[model samples]
Target: MGDLTLHGSVSPDSLKEVDQFDGQEMSAAEKARLEQIVWRKLDRWVLPIATIFYLLSFLDRSNIANARVAGMQTSLKMSNYQYSIALTMTYVPYIAAEFPSNLLLKYVGPRWMLPTMVTIWGLVATMQGVVKTYSGLLACRFFLGLMEGGLFPGLVLYLSFFYPRERLQIRVATFFASASLSGAFSGLLAAAITNIDGKGGRPGWAWIFILEGIFTFLFGFTCFFILPNSPATATFFSTKERHYVLARLKEDGAVSSDDKSDNFSWIEVLRCFKSLHVLMLTPVLFVLGVTLYGLAYFEPTIVAGLGYTGNKAQLMSAPPFVVAFVVSMITAVIADRYNCRGFMIIFFTFCNVVGFAMFYAAKSNHVRYGSLFLTITGCYCSAPPAITWVTNNSAPHVRRATSVAIAFIMTNAGGILATWLMGSLSPAPNYTKATLTNLIMSIASCVLACVNLAYLWRQNRLKAERRQLMTQADEPEGMGDESAWFVYKL
Candidate 1:
């Protein structure tokens, strides 16, 4: 079936299509045990594969920063400001097509969708190595972003099918930490690739894209056999296991079928825009996205400006991202254990606020660098949990899909703003404007976090009041979904 026809609320007809063998339902305890085993199996294959794919995607896209320092600009005769435009072009399509791509994923399926994207972008990445002029480079980067847009939102929707809302925080975190891994790895990879001297006279930066793109293309083709579409159609698991997984999901009030969500309500797309939680959460993610892209798009340039050689700057860039990855994992595990998404996110945003102030106020190079480490670590550490909470609170099926896609779409739109904030006109050695811009973004994120906390608290209070007035026989199905419920976690 086409993807657009593969989702929605579970109608009787739809349920019949997905109903498992024996028509037997298991107890809650049996469900729990099966979930444990399923997660173990999932961790073995799902997390690692998804994480690696995103890591490579991130690395290939952002390595241009490292390439800039590796003499890419000089070789191509592009100015510093032109580099920023190149970066902005990447986000153009990435933001424009994000939500639509999720809708498309309904029919295409990840088995085919993800790999096709990977293959397309991988080819683009390889072509990046061959670009001889500024326009050529811009064209490659724009196409790269266009192809990569579907990946994140699609994966977010895909993960929702297998994992319930409560268990998804750390899983999402694990996936997002791939960005930090890429941040660290990009430097090392660029360093190695920069050393490659081809007989054809291509520069090392070109080789970076070519080599990374090749792996991405190959991995995409491979994921077809590996990435499960949903509990309904997962090929790796036994039919009974698939049935068990589906039943467990019903317990969470998350609905699924082989039908497209667009079949039910196109207005559902706008529903996400109207949610208070979404409105507040989107800007918080927006600020963080800006910071992430700012760093990803320009970290190598910033490091190079610090008086280190290109190679040394790339090497130094690894440590801060390493710190971020470790901190992100720790935060994820803690948030999941406590079921306290809001508090942890606010805490991390606060850390960024402090880190940014420290960077802006500091005089010494050592102090400034230390502040940079803290800033990157804290903001990145919080992002996954914040995003996970936003997506999980949404309704099942298409609502969840649209909500998740909006979060990414909104966030990458901020990438465009961040790109413009640190214009190429700034002095090379001290990007005073960029540093201050990050500080502003950090503060903005913190403010958004607090606003969301308050909004969630108010909604919960209202819901509690509504419950108090309801008769025993009369209650709305606990908000939107039948089994899934939203509680303010702050």
Candidate 2:
């Protein structure tokens, strides 16, 4: 056995049939170099495309907040409740479509499904500019939700097919940071777009929708050409490179037997529901969702309440999200390196608790405005790690897909409460009710995260005990994270 050779002509499928390293043995240094090459290639091919698509998806979904400040509510003659209803309408279809969309992503490759969804949502978002009545606004939002619903969960599932659990946190964080970037960029973009008021016989809010929608629409077409289906089938790589990448993933236990097939299984779906961890984690995501979506949709409004009305408020919203983007990346790197997803989630959620507590009790506008940094960074930081925690634990292709869908559905369900709270508290000058609601939700999120951490620690202890009684050879293949050899990362 010597160093393995990667020629341009070798097929990826042929490598799967071999013993992986049967004919060739490489030195430890060579193996490390090969893995580095694969990772760098994947980083180039997958991460950027997914991050850009999510940025646009979030920008399209949450731009209503930007539009609200720009006069969409008044232009459509909508009350706070009606505007909230319109916001709520987006999540109704969004929630309904998540499970089915994950299932559909299994049938239609991500190359097609993800981009198609983005394109449709972009068109719907654009139509929002033309709606004259509140009913029309509601209709457009519903369709927008229907189109955008699958993207986040779909991307989560898609990434699992490529990276192992330990390496996944940073990639998921990189992808999710796009949402925070969109928050910051939306404020700056909205401030600029609002200056286009009365252009083309349209209000500034209408221009905001039309222009952002066009950018999203164009980006979707670009993704079609760049996004790969899987490492085995990626066209951008040479045949040998593809083969090496897929083989490495299998050696790492990142690629399971179920991942090789596209067949739908009812048994796998049932298995997803039976997992005690998933059951506990679902509600945890729900609570985190309440804090995250609440802040995302209303942070600008909260800023406006500090006496910076109109465009200044929109401009002010950028700083908190900028802080969130920085904190989320740093936390993700530390979580991945230390294998401490659970601890990091609890720490960040506590940051939210403290931030919101200050916001609720503060009298000065400056103090309240400063509190935004803590709240935004904490909420955003906890989210990616929490999501990665679930994906890392769920095994087999179908189970992972179904689990992610369930988690996202619960997350979006919180959006319904968030929008309603914003509307209900709209009449208050200080936004006392909304701030209090966020403070309570942040505290609840921290408690739930702590509970889940305890549960995982117990499970890990039980697994260690069982492992001591059995040999490695006794473990079965393809059991995914549930295999006796597979220790849970707490």
Candidate 3:
């Protein structure tokens, strides 16, 4: 028999697909016990795979900064303005690629799609080393951005498919912490690789690209074996375990079980943009690009400007990221446990405000350097929760995918702005403009956090009141967050 479709839904018989077994006889406590066992198994496989892949993505993308300090500019004969343009070029294609890339990820299985992107971009990152002319470098970066664009949004969506909403932020943070891990690792690697200066007619900066890209490419092959498309397809699970996992997600209001969310829909993609949460969250993320990209692309440069020139500067940039990785994990636990993502974002961003204000006002090098810790803390910690916030509220696959994609699309645009803020023309020692910009972005993020929280709270109230009146057939559109059953996370 054909599956029964629901009104205003792409999915049919939401629970029927997962009700294959006699598990209905089990008590809630037994289900809970099994859920814990299944989740722990998933965590062992999922978190490490996602975190390591993200670390490579971040490393390959941001290692250019470390290479720059290692003499990429003088070796390649590019001017500072030209350097900044090269950075900006990466993001232009990056931003253009995400929306479509996300749609494709929906159409295709992430197991097949995610590793392919990493492998191709890893190759692109390798080719970045061999470019003789500035144009060649620009072309590599552009394609690199094109290949790498889908990864983050893809990974987030991939995790959402396996885990329920509440368990997500910390898992997201686990992978996202790899950004800071990359920062630290990239610095240490760049510092060591610089010792290979003039090897095989290549400068140390070029070697940084070669080695890291090769490693990233190799890692991509492993992802193919590691990731399963979804719980239904995960070979590691027993038949009973698989059905139980799906049932747990279904109970969490993940969506209609037979909804087949992986099947692409243009309507769902377009509909997500109209969401009030997506609408408001887009600009807030855009504003946050100041610190996010600023720290990623220029931490080495920023540290260098503070007086630890060359390799010493790269090494110095490593600590804050190390600190950020630890702090980000702790922050995720608190936010998850308390269910206060909105408050966590505001608190962490406010730290950036203080960090930037301190950086801008500091008289000594040490103090300015110390402030980098605070800036890294806020920039890295707040983002996982922020992105997950949108995904948590969104339903089915397409809406969650689009909502997540749009958040990053705008954030990548902010990446371009972040690139411009610290470009060659900025003041040398103080970088007063970048400082002021980050400070303003931090403060604005805090304000928007409050506003977004308040708005969601209001919507939750309205939904609660209207929920009783809602009929299954007359419920809100499947793609819409306006459904009485859908509560926006504050």
Residue-pair clashes, model 2: 0
Local accuracy of candidate 1 as per-residue lDDT tens digits, 1-490 = 1322222223333343234447654566765666678778777767787788789888888888888878888999987678778988998898777878887776667778877888789889889988999999999989999999988887777777667667778888898898998999999988988888563688887888778888888888788777766566666677667666665565454554434333546666677678788888887888888777877777776666566676898898888899999889988888878877888778888888787688678777677677768878876788888788776677745566788888898788878876766556445556677667777777777788788878777777876676577542464322343221334445
**lDDT tens readout by residue for model 3, 376-470:** 98889888889989888876566777788898898889889888788775755788888887788778888888888888999899988876876
lDDT of 2 at 2: 9
- The residue pairs that clash in candidate 2, if any, are none
Q: What local lDDT does model 3 show for residue 48?
A: 84
Please give each candidate's TM-score. 0.90, 0.92, 0.93
lDDT of each: 0.74, 0.81, 0.81
Error of 2 at 178 (Å): 0.9
User: How many clashing pairs per prediction, in order?
Assistant: 9, 0, 2
RMSD to truth, every model: 3.7, 4.8, 3.0
Question: Model 3 residue 279 lDDT?
Answer: 80
Please report how far candidate 3 places residue 301 from its true position, in Å: 1.2
Candidate 3 lDDT at 100 equals: 80
Of 1 and 3, the candidate ranking higher by TM-score: 3
For model 2, state the Cα shift of residue 418 in Å: 0.2
Candidate 2 lDDT over 110-135, as tens digits, reads 88989999888889999999888999
